[model samples]
Target: MTVNIPQLRAFLAVVEAGGFSAAAADLGMSQSAVSHAVASLERELAAPLLVRSAPVRPTALGERVLPYARTALTAVRSLEEVAADAAGAMTGTVRLASTPTVSQGLVPQLLRHWREELPRITVRGFEGDSAEVAQWLENGTADAAILIDPPPGPGVQLALDGYRALLPRDHPLAGEAAVDIRDLADDAFLISPNGCEARVREIHRLAGVPFAPAHRVRDLATLISMVQAGIGVTVLSEVSRPLVPCDLVLLPVEPRTSRRLVLSGPRARRWHPAVRALAESAAGRLAAVS
Candidate 1:
């Protein structure tokens, strides 16, 4: 029962691409070859990895093995990068994960800076909610991630984004310089459950108000529209200001609370050379600014 790198790569590609054909195209192999590699890997493991559905998904066993496969591939990629490192020119892909809020807020500028600093290194962005982004980093699905409210480590602090109230333009609190959470207690509360729920709950608790939300909305655009239509108000990070429609108003919370965003390599594995380079570049830039 010996598994090899190619098989692992094929398995991962199939899972990430959601089908054999797309995996084949991505790996520059024939569909049959991709299918064969996956089949052989499954046979070696003596278990089925994919459900073979319209959009293929991992089995329970495959889910357990997915992280190991990703970590192994990261090691292989690092080995292949040694030569590029020695040549004084680093060239490879850095799979970077970010939550939806950070993706909308900070990722664009980070990408631009990376493009200027490391033109040869391709930085691919993977967007998910906070939990999914954390899972991606833990499972090695991403070489690096920008984590929210992360614990202190080798990671560089990117930003401290404060929570704010998003209200309709004509709302009574909209005219105030800052709004107390208790002030909006009687209004319909539409919660953005992506990553802000815990902080919003804390806000309510601190304000001595109930945290019951009238609606739980996932999409930022839909949340904004709901607020605009006067259906409800919501709480979001200050970083979300750019996404708010001009017709809506964002007010600072009376008691400021912030989430820390950090950029770091995957916690479960050694950093890829390209990821290390990117982190170093970011740290240098931050130090210069400070």
Candidate 2:
């Protein structure tokens, strides 16, 4: 039996908006119509979706089916984009997911390159943690994503990222070619709670030291501010070197740890024309990046 797109969309809207009435508002349909559509979808799939609570919640089966439904819809949308591309009428947005590391500095530069190269196309970006980024790709929330050391997938290698030490500009160790982890044992260290934190801590553990941060921050800007003010030192990806304030210096770590950055999409393969174009645009701008 062929699945109805409207019913599938109704189910998704309800799940995302958290209630039948909200989904109805989002879809510009009556609440009863939205409910009926969702019921039809559940019947077609032979699975129950929403719990019918005040704030709608997905059942276990609904959770399992949602991703597939999203992928199906994305594939349909991409097919339409493909037709537009073939006709030289492509002017659509590609949704991209990335981390703060690249989103803060590199992504904007890439976007500018995209605008100059492909003026007709639009690129929409979303920032999240690595896991969340992957989730966006899997759930079809993003057309493509910049992933760091992700699992096996068909993707383009963008960069190999190395971890570097961030220190105050005038710190004694800043002039060194590479800073040994032990050198900052006594310093008040500022660390982020996510992204690079675990990796940095793992390096410290390997060196027989604990990564004890005197301060915990989440935003990359705040992290840099703390380091710039001589509050502490921390480790970050080399890609973030460009973002270091003039008051701060980025030095290589003695035992370098690096991650591979790639552009991955659904199933690690991109199908949408916009996603492919965006990837090519980014690949063309590597030299401009610090």
Candidate 3:
């Protein structure tokens, strides 16, 4: 038998508000109707959901069922929102999060072109490390994101950027065609505190070198500045090369590894219109690339 939403709502309201009379007042229904709704729900489930108490309370079954009822109702509400967005020429704020490189190299151009498609929709952007971008998407702070090294399932791969070595111009290995991961073992390793640590460490492990990070900085520009001062070496994606300063040299890393640029949204909001648009825009842009 189907669970009646009105009856389920009534039961939850009574339990939450601590009395049927209060729930009835809050729901704008008569006390008798509220009681009948709960009663009807109990009958459908063949279970006793409420305790006939002084202030009213939930039975053991009611406590167990409350969370599922809330989840199902939340899903229904989200579906309604999706249907509403898709029904019209969508117009609303679309929040996006992305790594600093993509934020600089990709979004501005995309935003300029995107306005032509959904003229009324405003695109708001958040720039962060890939880790922070993913966190924003997961926590509902963003409608969509361009993430690097994304987890497999939730994202669509848009581009691939290989890891490259960032070295000081005067360093002994600066002119080398390629840098082996193990060659920099004794050198101080500057790293971005906000992102890419895991991948860097994995390469160190593969090269049988102990992982040692010398300077940890969140700002990419500052990190490159430190490299210019001969502070340490680091690895970053090739996509960030254009932003690199002249004093630093980027060499291809041996045993090549790549970071993926992916467009994704919250796992729960997979069908969100803004996220769908982001996926479409990213794919179309990549397709134009040689």
TM-scores for the candidates: 0.86, 0.74, 0.65
Task: Please give the lDDT score at residue 70 for candidate 2.
Answer: 86
The best candidate by lDDT is 1
Task: Write model 3 residue lDDT over 167-197, tens digit each, in one string.
Answer: 9889999999999988987789989867567
Q: Worst ten-residue run, lDDT, model 1?
A: 81-90
Candidate 2 RMSD computed on C-alpha atoms after optimal superposition onto the true structure: 5.0
Candidate lDDT scores, in order, read: 0.86, 0.81, 0.78
Please give, for residues 1-290, the per-residue lDDT of candidate 1 as tens digits: 79999999999989988899988876779999999999999999999999999899999999998989987887787777776677766678788999887888888888999999999999888789888888888777777999987776778888888999999888987899999988887899998887689999888877777889999988888898999999999898988888888999889986568898999887756677788889898888888788
Q: Candidate 3 — which pairs collide?
A: none
Clash totals in order:
0, 0, 0
Q: TM-score for candidate 1, please give it.
A: 0.86
Candidate 2 runs further than 4 Å off: 1-72, 88-90, 268-270, 284-290
- Candidate 2 per-residue lDDT over residues 111-169, each given as its tens digit: 78889988888777778999989887877777788898887867777788888999997
Off by over 4 Å in 1: 1-4, 20-48, 59-68, 287-290
Q: In order, what is each prediction's RMSD in angstroms?
A: 3.0, 5.0, 10.9
